[model samples]
Target: MKTFQEFGLEPKILRAITEMGFEESTPIQEKTIPLAMEGRDLIGQAQTGTGKTAAFGVPLIHKIAIQEERIVALIMCPTRELAIQVAEEIGKLGRFKGIRSLPIYGGQDIVKQIRALKKKPQIIIGTPGRLLDHINRKTIKLDDVQTVVLDEADEMLDMGFMDDIQSILKLVPAERHTMLFSATMPSNIQKLAQQFLRNPEHISVIPKQVSAPLIDQAYIELNERQKFEALSRLIDMESPDLAIIFGRTKRRVDELAEALQKRGYAAEGLHGDLSQNQRDNVMRKFRDGSIDVLVATDVAARGLDVSGVTHVINFDLPQDPESYVHRIGRTGRAGKEGTAWTFVTPREIDHLHLIEKVTRHKINKKPLPSIAEAIEGKQKMTAERILDAMQSDAYGEFKGVAIQLLEQYDSVNLIAAALKLLTGEKKEIEIELTPEEPMRARKKKFDVRSSGRRVGGYGSGGSSGGDRRNDRPGGGYGSSSGSNSRYPRKDGSNYGPRDGSSGSSYRGNSSSEGRSSSPRERDYGSGSRDRSKTTNNS
Candidate 1:
């Protein structure tokens, strides 16, 4: 394995890597770095969390002269979250070398990005559609680009950005080195490579071996309506020390966080739109265990190294196999056992098979924990807590009080009452989450046969594509479908009215005054979806 220093990187890039706290090269980094530095067009098949960024980034940074401007390197990612994540990591890797990397994606202010363009960054990371937009506007000049990378190329293909990718490629110099990384290689991806790359060196890492062996993977078949309830029950049963819930989009993250909070869980949402300070605070609270659950989109949670994450729940299945691996990788770190549960809607089973094939692991199908099971799990935790207290001699002061209580009540009853108090029976919350357009299903070519019972967007009947929209609630973020975007949005920019406070409360109408029958309808139909239900007896 080659080290960063052995790869002949400049002192500034090494300093930046050291400052970022990385010492060892992950397998992809070790293999890809040497070839990338040699200026070979390379194709890397590696999983996320395997440090592929540094593999492509190090060489890209090395080739950029301090005086070069107008994007010496360009990276196109599938989503805004990923675009920002890659840009941030690339910036960190290139910081000391005077190599500036900027993230340009839809749903952010084109004007703001235009202004940033004026600063003349050396590297540009953007989603396909937005990058094309910048190209058309003449805001980004790719003539100086010496290298270009398509990170998570499969995802962009799945999101229908292939045409845009080709269009952007045409604007750049055809002589640049290109690195493409994807966990699964579809034929279309191969076609794109063939069209753009010049006899690339193929480096394929075995996918099944990439994931941590300690992580236990499972799936629960659930209908969309039962999802929130199932998640609540699962939390009661699992009692994770710390957990990260992955949602597919920004709206899903915001809704899940709000719903979890309403149910009295110490939870918060993290996405691309949050200021660095806000993202930092949420992360701090999560690392310190102040928050039991963190709801986040994939982009926002990238590069996170929190060690105590005991569980990972895929509230919504990701678009491709690579994202599934990345989501599950958050747990099962530091040689510790972890659990990952994905909620599969009946329609999304095919996509699940795709993930299983790419990961080469059979995810065991698990029954959803019922309300009773949740109660039992809580009681077990209480029992363990009591046993621990006894072992630790924590009852010295309470012994006399316990004796006094025993005299008034039967000892067994007193113990049962104590357990009941500690266990805390589960509370059912009726939460209405705003439904999102399910991710585009991969064409039949990517599907591989698997036996796991599937649900959600991976089910057999799942909706694949929808016209993209960017209107989201709160000051939170929205997923840009490679089109017009207004990003770095303020509290006032969203559809739902806000009072400009802590980011809650509807602006126009209260959720209490019965309005629309569904969350999506409420937003689009100018009404509200009340959690309160009125039953009618026939």
Candidate 2:
């Protein structure tokens, strides 16, 4: 209920917050800001969507003087996406004050980073690995750091970056304030606090519910083979302003995106294999309303913050309850009501139930939409548009044309013609997706990171899921080890395979099994589809 002004932020930072549309402080911000501004080491335990970025960022920005050009604050995250997001948020917060923040991460060009470094940014936001790389190359100096943040310490530990974090922290001056944030604190995270922070003030902001209350969650039980058809029907019915379809693997993202395109949906694929530029372009298109749907693996979708996502479709169920929460959380943001639908295979119903139990939210079950219903959905939308136009008196321009057409035809026939023109015919596209294994179970735990999403939940991939060693081509995991969601997600967790083994042996690669990339060959309605602009975001 508290406003940013209550935290005693300076006028310049307050102006930026107002410009960014933040009127009130989130629970995390309400608690952490005052202490952080007082130069206290702090630890905040909260989920991603709770405004933790500003919780720490505002104070960090407030402390840094515009006259000091050296790096005074450094934030380390587990992934490049999170690093970029934090940097952008901090940059916006410090805009009016002329505080400079730069993001340095691996996938991006190091030479460019070196050039950015030369600009003497007073703050640096970077992933641990890349930060260490720069530290080793002597491109960065941290002795001037007045504050250091382990943005998602648990995730860095999960990704085996604990040593790097320690090393980075050690490089900072001993008299610096340190802030660490994480959703869950295991033993390792506590040890990290003990070593790095000086009697840090702990602030915990627990939400009333783990999942977003504004999201209307539902699920349809169906066979895996029938998923694409069911999803297409749902899309036709809902016609979301913007939607994200979460796939379990890279191939699933690619195949589903292409399949949706085949059925006349404006969709794009996002996965780890995508070049940074390609990822940026796809995200740009999604944010600008050029793409209607984004099919993505969990890793690829991490740290994604686009508003106006009206719906979140679990084309494939997430690996765990936490992921389910995060997946649906993508929609229903900015206090707007959103819809989330999951496709549950017959055997995966139990896994869905497990997710329900953990998030303490019930997922309504519904039957797959039939062909007639899909057509009816489209008709209903067209009718609504026409009615709105009539209400607004905007139809006056079309009244003369309507009268002219009616003069030559019966009113019923004329209305039918208008309906036909307005409602697009349902496409009978035959989409055959490669079957994937379901998750072993839904027992895997997800840490709520500062960026508001898990950094490494997609099993051992970077930002998006991919086998880094073999350079495996798949972007999604639903078809890989996480397939067969009927079982537990973690190999050895209480939800693991009943046989007591990891169950990874059954997973297989389907890429060798023939697929046509040329969308022109796949007939959707009547003509060849043009896919020259299809992005290889994967």
Candidate 3:
């Protein structure tokens, strides 16, 4: 790793980087910055959290001339969220240089964007649809554009934006600096690069093992009916500070989030159907710790870079191995340890193995947490909180009440009562989720020449070669349910608020005497339980 100073960046840019608390450059930045500074076309292949923004942002900011108050650089992203995110980062990098970057995207007022355009920002970051709309309307000019960047080009292609991208690129001058970045270089992306980029310098920062080394990956096998109870127990036991739960479809995300909230968990859902404002609000709450869990679909969660994410839970398996990698990458970032748990149905074991084969890492199988274990985990958390308060002397005001209780009862029993009060018993509310069809592993062919490596698409079913448009709704590529239907209404009844008046309970557990059976006992009929735990204690 190298410092920003080694790249000979301008003082203002270095100062901004320093103030941003970036001490050393990531692998992508260290390798791409110097070549990009030399004004060469380049192709960078890296996953999302590899600092690709700064890798290109630094040089892009340095080259902009503040005197020329026109759009000299253009960056294209796949979604509105990413467009805004990139624009903000670029804005920060260029703040000291007096350079301006504006984000133009759909779902926002076009009239407002036009007004912002009149401010003469030096850089423009936008999505393909909105950018091309501006270009067609003559609201944006590319005559003076010197640099063009295709961030997440693969995602744009997956969203069926290749033609729009081609139109935008063709309008730019032939003699210009172009950079393309993607996590995977499929055939179409390669062709797009060859046609646009001029002998681009190729740089790859993809690790040999695609999964992050710091992430503890595990999977639990159970029946489809048992997933919700298992998830609730896991959350109670793990007690992650911040967690992301990935679902396969928009409906799944909505239902899962609603169910979590009904269970007294602070959670929200993100998917393509949400308005821009709604999406922004959900993200703000998640980032600010107002919500402890975020339930999201793969496309909706794209390009999301949130810090302090302690866990990633796959409520439903992703459609492909690539998606699994992207989902888990949300955690274990910035050299921090994180945990990922995948719930696999009994029939989906083959698909799980396929993911392991692609990522070249083993995902350990774990037993479903028992209800008693969930209670014990909460007890441990309460004990830790008590210890922390004692160390900080935060319990001084309560000492008199504690002394009174100690005088009335045994100290151990009083302490146990306090823990019980603080850690309320698990609500016996039943939650019934719509069972989704299990994913089947697509049959793959191995190429002997490539050392028996699998060839072609890995269960996503998109064309491996060509410029075909992905016609999936909501710009998502995978097995997501195409329907935009809301959660199904049962018996023509609407669900009540979280007061526990109505809704299903855990059917897999016995409701008699308000006690649930252990998962192993319920599922396997009194088998020897595996009590091993692999969650991060920190």
Instruction: Give the winner by TM-score.
Output: 1
The segments of candidate 2 whose C-alpha lies over 4 angstroms from its true place after superposition are 219-232, 239-337, 341-370, 383-418, 426-538
Return the candidate ranking by lDDT, descending: 3, 2, 1
* CA deviation > 4 Å runs, candidate 3: 19-21, 78-81, 96-98, 105-109, 154-163, 184-191, 219-232, 239-337, 341-370, 382-422, 425-538
Best by lDDT: 3
| Local accuracy by lDDT, each model | 0.71, 0.73, 0.75
**How much is 128 displaced in model 2, in angstroms?**
2.6
Q: Which lDDT tens digits does candidate 3 get at residues 96-198?
A: 9889899876444456778989999989998776676577669898988999999989877765568778989999889899999998999999999999999
Q: How many Å off is the CA of 501 in candidate 2?
A: 28
What would the TM-score be for candidate 1 when compared with the true structure?
0.73
For candidate 3, the clash count comes to: 3
TM-scores of the candidates are 0.73, 0.62, 0.58
Residue-level lDDT tens digits of model 2 in 390-455: 889766787788789889989998777788998876667777787655432322234432234332
Better of 2 and 3 by TM-score: 2
